[model samples]
Target: MYAYYGKEKIRMQPLHLLMERGHSCKLADIVKKCLRLDLLEKVTMKKNSALMMVVLLLMAVVLTGCASDDNQAATRTITDMAGNTVEIPASPQKIATMTGPSYEMVFMLGGKDKIGLVRSDHATGYPLALLTNSDLPNYPTIKGVGPQTPVNAEQFLDAGVDLVLYYNNAAELEKFKMAGIPAVVVNTTTTVPTTTEEYFEQSSANLKLLSEILGGEAVERYEKWYAYLTKNVELIAERTKDIKEEDRPVVYWGNTWGTNILSSYSRGTRDFEMELCGGTLVAPQEGGQFPEINKEQLLEWNPDIIFVDNHGNAPELVIEDMYSNKNWESLSAVQNKQLYRIPSGVFFMDKGSTNTLVLLWTAKVLHPDLFADIDMIKELQYYYSTFYDYDLSEEEAQKILEGWVDAENLVR
Candidate 1:
C-alpha cells in the first residue's frame, strides 16, 4: 500500500513485515512509515503529553499539601491536669481564663498582654489583678458554665480566644471544643490535695505546664517562683518539724459565708497549712472541706488562734462581729484576740502562689519566737516585685497583709 502526505508519496509497510522487522522502532522509523502506522504510534504523543500534565499536577498537589502541613505544625499538643490532650497554639496570643484564680496565675507568668477574657467575678474576687494591671478590666468577661451559670460558646468564639484555662468541666470543655477553642482544665474539686506535700506537687506541675504553654520568660519565671516557694517550704519544715504535739496550738480557719458565722475549712489545704505551721487544726476531717458548725461546737474546740477568710465580709468586720457576739465571747480566739485576717493580694494567700507567703505568715502567727527572724513584709515586697513586676510600697504590702482591699481601684 502507498499514501501521499502533502506533496510526498510514502510507501506503506505490510503488518507482518513491520512486526517481523522489530517490536522496538525508533521515532524517525515510525514517522517514516506514516501510511503503515500502528495504534501505539498514534496514541504515544498524546499519552506523553497527558503524563506530563499529570506530573505537573501531582507536583502542585504535593507542594500544596506540604504547605498545609506546615500550617498545622504551628500548634503543639499538651496534656492538661484533667489528662485531656489538647492542641494549642505554640505561642498563644489571646488567652481566656474561665476560672477566677487562673487569671492571677496567667498574670504572674507574664501573660498579662495575652489575656483576652477573664471570669466575670475575677475583678471582685481578685482586686489586685485590676490594681496592678490597668488593662485587666478592659478585657471582656464571661460567666463560666457551672452550677451558677449557663454555657455560652458564642462568647468564647466571639472573643477570638486562642487558649482557655478552665476548671474541670467536661460539658464546658466540649462546648469550647465545638467552637474551635483550645481549653485546658487546670483545677478540679475532686483533686483537692489533703496534705501540703500533695498540694505543692500539684501546684508545681501546674506551674510547669502553664510555663511551657506561655513559653519565653514564663519558664524562667516559674522556676524562680517555685524555687522561692520550695526554699520557704523547706525553711518552715526545718523549723516546725521538731514541735511537740502538745506545744502546737489548736488553730481554726473561720469564714463568714453569706451571714453564716460558723463557716470553716476542715481537711483540705487549710488543715495542711495549719499542720505545716506547727498548729493543730481544730476542725476535724470528717466535716468535709468547708463545713458549717454550731456555736456550741466552736466553744468545745476552743481554738487558740483563728485565721479568717477575707472572701465574704471584710476581715475587720468579721472579727468585729465575732468579738461583739455573745456566743463567741467564751472562745479562746475571740477572748485572747488571736483572730488574724488571712492576707490576700491578687488572690487569697491560702491558695495560689501567695500560699508560700502564707506558710511563713502562719508560722510567725503561731510561734512568734520561732519564726521571728522571717520578715514577712520584706518577703511580700520581694514577691510582688519579682513575680508580678509590681513595686509594692511598704504601706501597700502592710495593707495586703491586713487583708485590706483597694476599694478605689476595685472593679465594680
Candidate 2:
C-alpha cells in the first residue's frame, strides 16, 4: 500500500506485522486489540480508538510533506559577465560584495538590507553611504578581497553569505564554486572601451545585468538611470561635435595616491569623458590606463586644465601642494588657476554611475559660455533624489561637488 504526501509517494507498511505471522488483520482489529490491552485507555478512555489512529496517521503524512518541502530550496540560474552559468538563491538574504564599487551599486539597487558584507576599504567612509544610510557604519566588512587579492571563500561562508558579487577573477570564481557559494561576475567589459559607442554599450550592459539579478524596483531604477545617462551623453556629444580642434583645451586628469600626483588615466572612460567635453587628453593612449608621468613629461604637455582624482588623498591638499610646488609653477593649469577637483559621492565621479554627472560637469567647466544654462548643483540634487532616494540640500550637494568628506562618519 502507498500514501501520497503532496507530490511525494510514501510507502505504507502492512498492519499484519502487529499480528501473528501469516495472520490477516484489518485496521479495526488492531484498534480493538490495542483497546483490549488497555493501551488506548492509558491516557484517556477514548470511545473512538479507530478515529484516533486515523488522526495520528494524517498528522504523520502532513509532517512528511512538510519535510519534503524543506529539502527543496528555490533558486534561479544566471549567466554572469564572464560567461559562467551560476545558480543562486531566488532572493538572497545575505549578499557579499567583493568589489568596492559593487557594494555601492548593490546599495543603489535597493538591496541595502540584503547586504551582509562589503569591502573594508570602501565600507564606512563613502559620502554616498553617509548621506543615504545612517546605519552604514555598522555594516560588516571583509578585508583583502579584490581584483588583485585572492578570494577567501571560507570567510564568506562563515559569515553565512548566500551570494557574492565580484569582478573578473577566474580563480576566485572557482574557489567560490568549490565552497558551494554562488558568485556572479559583474564587470561590464573585459577590456577598456576604445570608442564612445563601446563605452555606453558596456555601461548599459553592466547596469542591466545588476538589475536582472536584483529584480523588482531595481529594474525600474535601472531604466531611469540609463535614460538619464543617455540624455546627458547625447547632449554633450552634440554640443562638442562641432567644436574646432584648435579651440579644444588640453586637459590632464591625474590621480592623487599618497605623494604621487602624476598618476593619470591614459585611456578608457576618463579619456572619452574629456574628449566628449571639448578637451583633448594630454596623456597618450599607448601609455596604458594608469601611468605615472614624471614632472618633466607633465611640463612638456603643459595642459590648459588639470582635474585631480581624489583617490587616496584629499583633493584640496593635492591641489594646494601642486600650487606651491616649484616644478608645477610653469604649468598653464596652475598659472591660470584651472586646476579642479573631480566630484565624489558613492563612488568617484570619474567611474561608476556618477560618470554621467561628471560628463555634464566637465562640459560646463571646459566651455562655460556654451553650457551657461547647466546648473550642476541642481543636477546633483536631482540625481541623488531620483536614484539614491535621498533628498540633498543645496549645501550638501555643493559639498559633494567640492569633494568634501564627513570626517565624523568616515572610517579612516
Candidate 3:
C-alpha cells in the first residue's frame, strides 16, 4: 500500500480491518474527506478513462481502508459443462474432485498439493491415488460417493476445499450451489471422446478452460499436452491418409468384459477411431450409440480386429472371455490373433490428454508399418513423467501397451 503525506508517496503495510457498517460512501465525498488535498494538488494525473476509473476506485478503497485478503476475495464466473454459471476463486488454494478421469485431469494440470480430498465412486479408489507418489489415498476420502450419495457439506468445509471439480454429481452440485460453495463441473473424459479429432478438440478445450480456473502451472502443462497430441495425430493422419474405407480391416470394441452382450462403436467417436486406425467398426446397423449385437451378427461381421477397453475395471476377465470362448474362435480377429486392448492408467488413454496415445496405439495395431519405428513405451514414460510427475517404469509401460494392470499392486 502506498500513501501520500505531503509531496512523496510512502509505502505502508496494509492493516487489516473489519468492514464497518455504512463505511462505503459516494466517490466524490470519499476523495474530499480521505485524500490529502496537498498530494492531489502536486501529483500529475492521467486523463484516460481506464486510468481515471482506477484512480476513482482506488480513492474509494483508500477511504474505506481495507480488509483481510479473505474478506476481499477475487473471483470470476464461468459456465461449466453442466451449463451452471459458477463464480470461482481467481486462484484457488484448496480443491476437491471426484476421482476418475476428472480427478486425473486435475492432478495432471495442477499437482496434488492443492488437491486436499477426493470423492470416490466405483472401485472405492482413485487410479492416480493408488498408483502415484502423490499419496492420493492419504488425502481424506468421501468414499463410495457420487450424485445420489449424501451431500456432506460439513465434510467439505472441514477439509478447507474452496473449489470442487465434479463429474456426474448433480445432487451434490446443487447442494454446493445452495450453500454458496463454488463447484465447477469438469467432464475431462468419459465415453464422449470417440474419434481422434474429437479427442484433441475436447481435451484441448477442457485443459484450456480448467487452466483458467487452476491458473499458473496448469497453463504450461496444457500447452505441453496439446503440442504432444497434435504431433502424434498429424503423424498418424499423414501415414494413413490414402487408405480407403473398404480396404480397412473390420473392427469391434467392447467396454465390458463379456462378448455375450456384444457391443461396438457406431457412427460416433469410436467409429472415427476405427477409421483413424485404418479399420472399419462393425456393429448392428440400428440400435443406438452402443448397439448390442448378437452372436449371429458377430459371425456375419467377423471383424478382422478387436480392441478391448482394459481400463473398464475388468480387463483380465474380458480378455479371458475373448480367448476361451469357442464362438470367438471362428472370428477372423481371434484366429489371426489381432486382438488388442486399450491402454489403462490414471485415465484411460482413450480420453483426456492421453487420447492421442490411443490413436497411436490403435494405429500401431492396425497398421504396423505406420508406427514401425515408434517406441510406445518410451512415449508413455515421457508423457506420464512430464505431465503427472509420476515415473513410468519400463515394465509398467509394457503392461500399459498390453492393456493390463496388476490391480492388487495398484488398487486396494
Candidate 4:
C-alpha cells in the first residue's frame, strides 16, 4: 500500500505479513514493539527501511538540539524567606537588580555584562569603580529620593531592565509587581537565624547563584572571594564558641539620630549581622524591629560596647559630652574605651550598597582579643578589589575608618 511520507509515496506491508509469511524479520518486530502499533497494510522492504532510518534520524537531531539549548541556559536558584524555590535562567543576559544590596551580589557573581538598569542609589557611593560608572548602559540615574521618598516603577522601566533582585520587603514587593517586572526576594538581614550554618547558608547560596549566572571566567574570581569569606566566618565561629555567653560583647545599634531616636537590638533581619557575631543588643529589648530607645534606657543597659550607626549624634560625641553629666561613666564600655562607630561609608553609606566589608569589621570589633590578628584595612581592600573590581587603596580604607571617628570628634 502507498503510504504518504512527506512529499513522497512509499509502499509498505502490514505487520501480519511478518508472521503469516514466515518472514524472519527483525525490522517488523522492532516496529511492532518500539512504535507499539500494527500496520494495516504490508510495506516493501526498501520503504520500511527508509522509514525507520528517517524516524531515528529525526529523533537524534531533535534531542541533540534540545541538549545544546539546555546546556546554554544559565542555571541559578534562589531561596526565599518562606523556603520557596526560584530557578533563574542560566546566564541571564539582562538582569535588572532593583535593590542596592542585590546589585553587589550581581556584580560579585561576574554579571557586569548582563547587568541592565541598576537601582539609582547604586550610581552614587558604590565602592566598586566599575559599578559607580555613570556611562554603563544598564544603570540609569535616579535622583530626588530624600530620607523618605520612595522610588517609582516607571523609572526602572525607562532604564531597560529584565530582573529585579531585592530584599523581601512588603512595600517593595507591591511596588515591584506594580512595575510589571520579574522579581525575586533574597533575605540576608536576619536578627537571629537560629543556627550558625543557617546564618551564612543564605549568603553563600546567593554568591553561588551569582557565580552560576555570570558563568565562565567570572565564576572563578567570585568563588575565591566566597571561599575566603566562608573560611573567615568559620574561624570566627570556632574561636568564639568557647567564650562564655556572658563574656560576649553587649552592643547597641543607633539606626538614626532624629526626634525620638530608634535603635535595633536582635530585631528581625535588621540586626542580623550584630546578632550573628555573638554580640548582645543593649537596647529597649530584643526581637523587635527598631524599637524606640530613650537615653535613660541606654544608660540603664550600660552596654559593654557601643556602635554608632553613622554621622548623626556620634556615639563618641554622646559619650564624651554626656559621660560626665549623664552618669554614663558607669557603663563598662566607657571604662574600657570600647565605644566605637561602625564605618558609615560601608554600613550606612547607601541602602542599596552591600558593604560586605562590614562583616569582617564587625567580627574584629566584637572579638578583638580573639581576632587580634585581623587587619580590617587590608581585608576591606581585598573585598573591594575582589567583589567591586576596584582596588580600594589602603589610604581610602584608612580614611573611611577615620571618617567614622572624625564624625564624632568634630562635634566637640
The candidate 4 region of ten consecutive residues with least summed lDDT is 15-24
Best by TM-score: 2
Q: Give the candidate number with the greatest lDDT.
A: 2
lDDT of 3 at 72: 56
* TM-score of decoy 2: 0.79
Predictions in order: lDDT? 0.72, 0.73, 0.66, 0.55
RMSD values for the candidates in order, in angstroms, are 17.8, 13.0, 12.0, 14.8
On residues 1-412, what C-alpha lDDT tens digit does candidate 2 reach at each position? 3333345543333332211111122333444454464554443322356546654664444334444333553467899888889887766777887764677677777778888887765665676666787766677888777576887776876677778888777877888777667899885455566677886887777668778888898888888899999999888888999999999999988876755778876666666677889989887565643678888888999999998876755667779998999979999999999999988778666666677888898999999998999999999889888888899999988888888654333332
List runs of model 2 lying over 4 Å from the truth: 1-73, 191-196, 284-289, 406-412
Q: After superposition, how far is residue 202 of candidate 1 from its true place, in Å?
A: 2.2
> Could you arrange the candidates by lDDT from highest to lowest?
2, 1, 3, 4
Candidate number that wins on lDDT, 2 or 4: 2
Give lDDT: candidate 1, residue 163: 84
Evaluated against the true structure, the overall lDDT of model 2 is 0.73
Better of 2 and 4 by TM-score: 2
Instruction: Show where candidate 3 strays beyond 4 Å.
Output: 1-73, 120-131, 147-154, 168-171, 188-199, 257-267, 283-293, 404-412
